[model samples]
Target: MAALLAAALAVTGCTAAEPGAAPRAEDARPTVISVTDGDVDLAILGEVYARVLTSGGYDVQLEIHSAQDPVSSADRLLAGEADFIVGCTGELLADFNPAGAEEIIDQWPELEEEGVGGFVVYDELIASLPSRLSATDPSSATSCDDAAEEQGLTQQVVPIFGATLFDREQREALTGITRLITTADLEDMEEAAEETGSVVEAVDEWVLDNEARSGGAFEDDREDVSYLYTP
Candidate 1:
């Protein structure tokens, strides 16, 4: 499972046609931007933003680094080494407050105003076990498997991401695990268990089946099943 997760992370990590290709001398003043490292989707998005800015008559320079150590990048922006930092709202919030940096523009209004959500998944069997399993005594033969059969339950998939959950620790831990099949909310758990095998379908299906009542759980993003799915 760990190997599978590492593979997934590798597949998702950023790649570029050319690293740090600067514009010609005659181009407009460069607009440098930095993004969190290891986040492939955000890295690609940052590159796209840089290209767009360059085409719009602004020379662009983009850098990718780890959010775990973002202070130096933020310092670059403040000291004029870079023009902007592309990162999560939390980073912006922290930097803006401490460094007195003002936002020239916000590309993602949704993140600025509404915030993001996370995805979560859990083992379906956890809920199906006999009530006796909850007993304080460990001498009982009860187990997660026993609960799975007693409830005639089927294994289900859950999805989670960073921005949604209130707990950052839990979210980070989930990122390292190959299989996470539970949700923080019980209602979401029930809805996910009902979906069973079709967890990878459209977001609208999840919304219709779970979100309205479950108060918005994680949306499924599993494209390859060999990692977590077991038949």
Candidate 2:
């Protein structure tokens, strides 16, 4: 993993196109975004973002590793090897602020009874992020919410990014993607991937289905779908 990250950093900004060749469509792209990969669900989410961002005119690259561990992936994102990652609220809170995880989880049920809701954890996560990083508004969908109910954590899926890397338009586009996802949608995507034997193929099918269901809500053209988000 160390060697791979070093190699990625060594050539972070270098492009491979020949100088004399006529400008290709890729040449005009404004940003080349690097995204990290992890377990099956995270990998699916990464590809989903890649497709959405590509349609918005940015070049997206996925960094696949031999092993997919969430903590290591989060560390890589903090070190700036990649621009973005799909994370969860409770899980990331544990990763970034270990000592507080149990206390926060303990306090959650009472907060819910009093009507504070899941934002208790989400707000804590926002406060815990470093100055160099920012996270999108979390999706209602969580990779672990039901399965890990015993753990008393609300693992809301969220897109985390390097703050300095994206402009306002890019950030809003990503936030839009976050809002459109749901837990049921994620489960269906995973099932589709299992049947298709390819994450990309499954995500493509899911995108088409979503577009049709919402009257083309997930259109590729940025101008066609206007997403109004604050961050």
After superposition, candidate 1 runs with Cα above 4 Å error: 1-29, 66-70, 98-231
| lDDT per model vs. reference | 0.31, 0.61
- Residue 23 deviation, candidate 2, in Å? 22
Give the TM-score (vs. native) of candidate 2. Answer: 0.72
Per-residue alpha-carbon lDDT of candidate 1 for residues 56-114, written as tens digits (9 for 90 to 100):
23334566666466355446554555543333322223333422212212323433344
Candidate 1 structure lDDT: 0.31
The candidate that wins on lDDT is: 2
* lDDT (Cα, 0-100) at 85 in candidate 1: 39
The residue-level lDDT of candidate 2 at 228 comes to: 17
Q: Pick by TM-score: which candidate is best?
A: 2
User: Can you tell me which runs of candidate 2 are displaced by over 4 Å?
Assistant: 1-38, 66-71, 145-150, 212-231
Q: Which ten residues in a row have the lowest lDDT in candidate 1?
A: 134-143
